[model samples]
Target: MDEITEGTSQVDCDILVIGGGTAGPMAAYRAKKKNPNAKVILLEKANVKRSGAISMGMDGLNNAVIPGHSTPEQYVKEITVANDGIVDQAAVYKYAQNCYEIIQELDGFGIRFQKDENGDFDVKKVHHIGTYVLPMPNGDTVKKALYRQLKRARLLISNRYMATRLLTGKDGRIAGAIAVNTRNAEFLVVRAKAVILCMGAAGRLGLPTSGYLFGTYENAANSGDGYAMAYHAGAGLANLECFQINPLIKDYNGPACAYVAGPFGGYTANNEGMRFIECDYWSGQMMQEFYNELQSGKGPVFLKLNHLADETIGEIETILHEVERPTRGRFQVNRNNDYRHGMIEMHISEIGFCSGHSASGVYVDDNACTTVQGLYAAGDMASVPHNYMLGAFTNGAVAGEHAIDYVNEVDFADIDEDFIAAEKERVLAPTKRDDGIPPNQVEYKTRRLVNDYLQPPKVTRKMQLAQDRFAETRAVMENEMVARNAHELMRSLEVSSILDCADMAAFASLFRTESRWGLYHNRADFPERDNENWFCHSILSKDDAGQMTIKKKDVDPYIIPIEDEEKDAYDKQRIKAQA
Candidate 1:
């Protein structure tokens, strides 16, 4: 092997938006629109033109807060109920209020939303209440539309750089970030007045049952970078115990897309083709029911689309195959299964953290401001429950707009030399080692352990055991993991982040004693929702000693109060069998 050459580069920007996926681009674009003269940089690990969660593009807005469809208050109530009442209503409401504007703005940018014959928005109900699901039959071009708008905004674009750690100033505020060029192995020291973390979810933390690392429900690139970065930088992440386990196309590992199919009369069913759940909304409660049915000797579950008319089936195929994950059609064809004749097999995805579908992410307020000064987060990585695509856009807008105002108030601070040197050594260590455990192997092992121990109906001893395995994985990170090249180096760094998320997941799960959020945090040992004691957010952060610390923070008072009778609206989602 040739001698590995190391290089360094520095950049100065007024605002830095990390992860160009659904949120980062919006953040960067909005920041530039807010202050065109202010230097803004949109940094992405992959091509900004196609990256993050919506890299292939999304099928529709899972949470579109449009007029005549849903009110922000009703949306808030639905999300709160969906998430089992452990949510920051303020943050959720903010997204609900502003998401419509972002949708209109995207529409103006040439992104299409399904409209009725009467010219009003064609919206559908996927949530237990309210019609929030807005389909985009041509939604595959969403990233392209955003890319066009991003170019129009003219923000500086840095692609193929994986952000490893956040840099803090002497004042303990976010000064910048440390990143490496994934292709060339060039180290980067980026100095920005404000940094918005929109690195999507920790999708790669767990191995897909297919044993394909990249075959995750979320984009393969989201390896918990934002969650780990924020935690190491002392940002509090909430409800990590509330893991992201979606009902996906078995083995293919993507959404069976209840939101898209349910409106067209497609529903999740057991082998008997009977609807078990009243609603197809992807919630913890809904998942709990799905899991129960699958485990209840009705072993294999499926998306029942065969019952639909030929025209409807054709429409579903057009939306499912053309938009979002286009690979699903090929997967079905390869398996010799057609939606018109057979039920699409469904399975529970391996555990991960995603605020898009379930509530587990870096805790942020309504303004998209994280607890850490000068650091902000949004999208699936930030804790705004069930924000989905539209939430990502609205929160990205919030982060970008607020960051501009923040940058105006703050000045560039000096980066700590010791910290920089330490981070550099940490990131470059894998490259220096000749051979040891490969990054893919380490990631796979850690994720396999996650499935073995942390998939819920959580047992106390099992989670404790998961912690022990995670500690072993941490040991592997320190002593065994190796990278042969820059791309491998990026994977190696991601393994460390995944380990951090795994440890946090186990720790947070153990801390929250009572079962809640349906299958998301269902503790087998304590099978009850203990609102009197455990109703607040379970926040995890690194302490002074660099140890993971768990604390209970009160859920902010609700702006829109739920009636006592309505609190259990999502509890009995299962449709009982007729005697």
Candidate 2:
């Protein structure tokens, strides 16, 4: 480990795993285990013990394919339909095939899962057509389990260091990355043979409805760092227009836990206490229905659990309160609303890019390799549609193990000192200024523009205006944004990432030209799905001339074929009225 100082410092490692969240730890652990002699460093902007999306832990596996309950083929087809057939089935299939082993490994790490009396893994139905949800009653301690594995594997962990940019070699392969200490603003250059990015999602791209900046559905720290880094590194990002929008608690902005509660006789209902959608699975179609309900006279949807028996409600509360967003229980109590007597109010979440819940992320193949050489992306940041936490683990392991093979065949690329110097100057510029626009103001305005112009039910003119406004916001961030200290500097840097994502979101949404993923890319002018003109994956990247470009990449042919009859499964989420 290199000593920390006021000046720039450098460290060399065989592999550098960015983001200590769900995927990054698994990636680093697998890399180190593959070759005990290799020096693998897991870099996190926050402490490994409590960081990323699952910092407090998750409630359950959103897409678990345990043997008896579900098969990899079934899971692949389900995700394919859910994503509107614009999926890389191969990538989804790979995650499903390997996820069972990853679960067993996590179980070995002392993470507990809900199992039946026969010692069989307890699986429940949450999706529209499959049984995939596997609960973790004691899931709040998940991060602790991962921390233990990382230490036992002897992988070096670096906390409080946020990477700003990727360092590409002369040959355009990944050379290293440049990061800054969030505490002291110290610039540190990490040179590595390979790099794996698992930096969650562009969660903070949209401002919460509550007017709180940090109150987002995804972790607040996941401010599109990986998305920005990959774009600058010249990697193609897939389906940026297919944004992540969830049905969350109103004002509180936490998950309503439909997966956990739906299996226990809880459901999403209108004010009339009538169920609207047939399934609780989160898809764009489902969100479209949710948005419609909010717009209809039957407005203000609720997660209704008041009809269930006392014991069932108690079990639901125990799981929902103890894991995932534990603060959810407290929030309900603050409102004086109990599940036994009343329903939890729900609303549509603000839009952001996330492959974990939706299908917008850095493009990667089945093996987790990105378009750039020696660079791999997994977790929510990577483009495996609807790949929840278990997908993060499986893909992280794949990236880590594959990177080892690549590192063995190559030598360390030369680091350009001039590039590092330039980045250091750019990163530290805000601190040098005595007074200017605060980062919070710029971020607030940028995200406000995101909601105003880029939020779905998208209009072309508004999206065009979004580009103009974001450019202005970027100018403010670059020229006038000021930071009083290192912490403020970190926030300032995050503003840049958020702006990049906001730009990509607008650009990709306009390029698609059709309303494909329901509300995710719903163009008001082009209000219908057009498979004839736009049926491929929309790829967004930074072109050679240093400009953002959009192009179409053909979706991979499905290995587990989907019949025409099954392709419209998700489109039928709204329940039909009986005579």
Candidate 3:
């Protein structure tokens, strides 16, 4: 890292991966492996060793298409139908095709996976129609394995830097990005031939029920940076209205995680301790059912494990407590709740944008290439439709390898000084303020507005009203939000990203008039799925007049056709009682 002059640092690389999370590390590693001599820099707001969604480590692979258990074509069709037949099948298929290879690669890196006594991978069924979940009893060290590989690859790791915006060339190709150090508040300008945006999901866009600003289902650091940067860089966002809402532990804000407990006979039960929905997979339809259960006389949902034998409950507890949000066990213990004797209470999580769980994120093709030239995305931020952790590694590698080929043909583009100067002022304005509203206050207000106006069962007028309130919030943020130090500055910048995401969510919801993707975009004004009018992807992008514009992109023809019998399989998730 070289300093260009005072208050600014200039770094040059062949490829700039603007996230150190699940996808960015893999992307940087793969890019370097492909070219060897090419400079691949992985930038992170926090340390690479403990960051992103997997910082605490994952319990298992959510969408692993292992051989003999599930085929790529079957996995693709499952995701397509689960997403209400609105997915780009090619993209989902691409992830499925390469995910097994990625799993093998991770295994070689010393990450442990649950295997049967026959020495074969032990996969479980968690989705509506396919087996996908593969548990990792010792999954806590996943990041350690990745970190070892990243060091071996010799990729440049720049941590504690929060990327503010992307720097595009005159021809609108991605040149590089502008970032600010969260620790020292120093400005960084990286010039690269290509850039990959993997800044996780917009987790902090909605206020969690706990009232803690950082208490979110996704990592708190993932404050919609990638989505905001890509939008400003002229990239189209897909299905922003298809928000990610999970059934999490009430007040704790961590997942009840049916994927972990479902295979061992754990289920979501209403107040009566009886199962309602047939499946526990995190889909829009499944969430709709969960929401409906909460609205009914049942009122509350719980992870029903008390019915299981003590031995079975112990196995589930060992996996759940030791990995992927270890705090869940502690939170439970603090409440005097034990899996063997009592059920873990569950609640619907606050809304956010995440393609890792639902299908709303920056638009990308099968190759992980975004609409903008030289710009790519993967993981939660990219629209690959229910592409959990495995998709991140698979698509990250795809983005990296393809970017190497792209950079081989293109030269580094020049960034404009005027743009950099304008960005510097915009970024530093809060720090220079003598006194104004604090970042947390503004963030709370902004997210509170999100919960108030944007939590779906979607109404047309409320969504329109959300845009107006968001506009007012944006104005207040610009004028009055102040940060006293470098740390506060990071939070201030995140508020801007959160507001940008909130606005996009409302705009996209309003753009599509028909109800689709279950509770995700269940428009009350138009209460039916209008496949004839709204089957296409609703794309959100910045127009030439510098305004957010909505357009429809037709779904790509499915290479693996979904039969009529399978199209509505998810709609039948509710277990109907016999007459």
Candidate 4:
């Protein structure tokens, strides 16, 4: 706690991008690309070899790079429909327009796509926006391709870095950030005029039992890091209640669950072998229709069908290096291909298991500006509210371009020496200080509290208890926290995020007052959708400490004049060309 201190090296730049994952890289790339003279640097906690969700070269770039049965308009339509009237239609159209470009951009960076037996591009069939399957490619390849360009640009990469707190200028605008280099235990003060927070959502705020869909079996690294930093800085967070859970798997590392497809019609079952969708609660019948064949006692072993053809196998071989073994005196793909070989046997459901997409995050204007001055968020860190995963790439690109434009217009200055020194002194002071509650301990306690009492489900009693308990835990943490240095300061911040965001997430969950959606959040108290009580957005902010103040925002339902349908179609076609 008090023993840990913040890093001390001070360096100023034009733009400081956080979280070297998805949006982070594209932001860094676009920033520098737009402004050739701008000094750009990306501060990544992880290394160039392993940053971004695309690092492994197999993340399945779902924006649809290949031609399928559907057109770009169809893609946009699917996303809008699946999102259930909550998607940013404009953003969807924008992303859909650039979907091919994103893939082409990645390929230009040396990421090889799976080719047909005749050495041409190939496509794979995947689940569509909802019930059907659509063709897409592996996503990990996308990450590797981005890495290639980043290396070409010589973007500054600070690996093994853990940023604990954001630095602000005299005007209270987000100026830069301070972090620790875990490898050598040194301090780094990154000063930038513009900061983009790409940190993921609430996996870090809940109990160990709480998890993302594909990430449920594996521990999550997203501590709502971006959410925490933005919230305290006056950013509004929306739709925090929309946490998606993939109930298909108990673990990503355990035995495959191929049998679920049998009893549940075409859908897979949980370990209980019961078609959970059969419960009386659901009225829409979307999930239940999927449950029939897989839930039937005599279901087929759809798991054994091999989906990864030769091209996919080759792509797998090219992307995974370290995980590969030697074949013919040359290393080939070293991966869980054994699992794929058995995907049809039992793990057929694994294909549908990754539910941790960012449905909600920091609220930003159409321009991608957050509530805080000189700070902006885009990509997954910002809330699409009504959009799904298809938007992350296009959104990242848009945000990157916006940040570059923003930096050009803002009046910039050098790094504040006083702030850096004070941070340095604060970090150094911890070594001289004595015992205090550790950041890890504060974080652990807070997560345990939220995971136990404050899930997405909003019951009256549970919400009140969670609200009070979250407040209590935050008070205890703040009081017990003893930090004279930078390291200790960060520990305090990490704990602060969980405690503060727990109330934020809970408030949003309670205000919604319905279990209208979410595979995991079933509210017994609010049994039905009370659109009257819950139609508006539930937004939360902080007044220092972790206390939550809730506000309601008007829902702007989309409208298009019926007679102008032909004109709208022409406009859409035009927008597609520009995008």
Residue 37 in model 1: lDDT? 98
How many pairs of residues collide in each model?
0, 0, 0, 42
RMSD of each: 1.3, 1.7, 1.9, 8.6
Two-way lDDT contest, 2 vs 4, winner: 2
Could you estimate the TM-score for every candidate?
A: 0.98, 0.99, 0.98, 0.73
Cα distance off (Å), candidate 3, residue 348:
0.4
Top lDDT hit: 2
Candidate 1 vs 4: which has more lDDT:
1
TM-score of 2: 0.99
lDDT of 2 at 358: 93
User: Ten consecutive residues with minimal summed lDDT in candidate 1?
Assistant: 1-10
Query: What stretches of model 4 exceed 4 Å from their correct place?
Result: 1-7, 65-69, 115-142, 167-173, 183-186, 210-219, 253-267, 270-358, 385-390, 413-433, 436-440, 481-493, 543-547, 557-579
lDDT of each prediction vs. the true structure?
Answer: 0.90, 0.92, 0.91, 0.54
Error of 4 at 318 (Å): 12
Write candidate 1's Cα lDDT for 381-413 as tens digits: 999988888889999999999999999898988
Model 2 segments beyond 4 Å from truth? Answer: 1-5
* lDDT of each residue in 1-579, candidate 2, tens digit only: 222236788999999999999999999999889999998999999899999889889888989999999999999999999988999888888899999999999999888999999999999999988899999877888999999989888889999999999999999999999999998888889999999999999999999999999999999999999999999999999999999999999999989889989888899999999999988899999999999999999989999999999999999988878887888889989999899998889998888989999999999999899999999999999999998899899999999999988899998888888988888889988887888999999999999999999888999999999999888888888899998888888999999999999999999999998898888888899998999989999999999999999999998888999999999999998999867
